[model samples]
Target: MNNINTRNLDLNLLVVFVTLWETQNVTRASERLALSQSAVSHALRRLRDRLSDELFVNGRGGLLPTPRAIELIGPVREALAQLDGALKGAAPFAPQYEQRKFRIAAGDIIEFLILPRLVAQIAHEAPNVIVEVLPYPQRNDISSLLENGEIDLIIGAPGPTSASLRQTPIISVPLLTLIWQKEGLTQERLPLNLYLERPHVMIEMHQRGENVIDDALRAQGLARRSGVLVQNFMAMPVIAEQTGYICNLPAQIAHVFAQTFNLSCHTPPLDFPAPELHAYWHNRFDTDQGLAWLLQKIRQSASGP
Candidate 1:
């Protein structure tokens, strides 16, 4: 389209398009926007005419984006985010009573440590607020999600460096070796030989990839015997109890799991520094009061329990 034709387009149509793409249902998108279903449908029809494409089509369970939508979604979402941030100047956030929601992207490990405290505080203070936790996305989607304001915070490895992002360390604790007593291990601290010889039940977030411990082992030209591979830390206790495989986990959570299961926690025989977890957010939201409040809550969650 020419500049004149593009200038004739309504900005509200783009908002409707992004909402539909996110919700993937006309009814849900309309409800979210406080618009009647017919009004949302009409907006979509007008958008299709201006863009000259069937942006979405009926699909199983919900609407699916066509090729054009997938192509344009990124740019449209970014543009909307910039405008939304500019317009949200110095709005006061009332955690005590605001009916607001904050979505966070985090791994189960951090969720194990932080969610309990965060939820308790939310329930006590902000009865009407919602806290949604989503799994950490892959590399590229992390940047896209933060820029689009889809998530308020992300807790995991550092993402791509960008001027729009702000990040700070969350926590770091030594990794301890976890083992079932049936393994006949009696040293006050596990021996390096036993550590390397024992069959290891490992947590590899990326399938078949090395975790922090494995990476350190590789640096010394050593590796552990892999008996089983699981995805999350929550499952390791069960497998360790039934089998004699050794598992490694962060010290705090490892002790918690040790007391619950009949497993024992020992200082890891290897010498490597603990990896740091960090929280990331978009710089554009520096003045978003709700986000600022929630960030403080998260930091408090990490400081104690």
Candidate 2:
């Protein structure tokens, strides 16, 4: 194959090419690009002539990309993304000024525990920026979401690491025992056997059968009878209040709920380690000025001065 000429190649034509490739129809691409259908057709012809290849051919229902077109897609998209980043100036996350929406994937617990504070901070600082938080059903796929630009960030427990993802530790706090009224439980700390004997409320958000508490219990050959299963930490207080069920949750969140719902919190007797929470993102956005600024602000809020 002849190398395409670097000189006299219009960059704007590549934008049209990408739009047409994605939409696979001149009429649709024209509508999406706010250009006439004839204009889009003319641009495709020009691109074909420039590259000496019929990039797409009409198929059964839609335009199909030719082999050469398939080969060009990755490089073209990457080049355009680089060009866009350069032209857009420094910050990628300037929600105060930029009109881009940031998508975040996190568990319900993290949303309940941390988002209110983060949103308050964003409202005061980056009022124009919009945030969409989506639930991550499988924590293992979080790295894939960041790599594919599906999510800008993931806030959750310390997840398995990948080469493409970078992590920033926010805070690590011990787990506390959450119970309803302290009617029967007199001691501030209950023994491991007693804790396991009591009926407990479990929050199984990500994995169905596996839980951090279960793993800890298995280590000591002890198991707690799950009286109820709830999905979110926010529901734990309400459920425990009604059923007198005990729950183990992050100390920060447990304390917050305890104060609000007038629940009792105590140190668990088991030797369970504390959960470590971290924020992970694609390394590609590490140097982005706007994302960097937002991350710093989040860290400040999470860690305090």
Q: What TM-scores do the predictions have?
A: 0.67, 0.65
Clashes of 1: 0
Instruction: Give the lowest summed-lDDT range of ten residues in model 2.
Output: 204-213
Model 1: ten consecutive residues of lowest lDDT: 203-212
- The Cα local distance difference test for each model comes to 0.83, 0.78
Candidate 1 pairs with clashing backbones: none
Kindly list the per-residue Cα lDDT of model 1 for residues 104-127, writing each as its tens digit. 988788778788899888888889
Which lDDT tens digits does candidate 2 get at residues 132-228?
Answer: 8887647667777898888888777775678888988876657899776555566888666767777888887554223667788888887898888
Candidate 2 residue 283 Cα shift, in angstroms, is: 2.3
TM-score of candidate 1 versus the correct structure, residues matched by position = 0.67
| Candidate 1, superposed: residue stretches over 4 Å from native | 1-91, 207-210
In angstroms, the error of model 1 at 93 is: 2.0
Clashes of each: 0, 0
Stretches > 4 Å off in candidate 2: 1-95, 182-184, 205-210, 259-262
Clashes of 2: 0
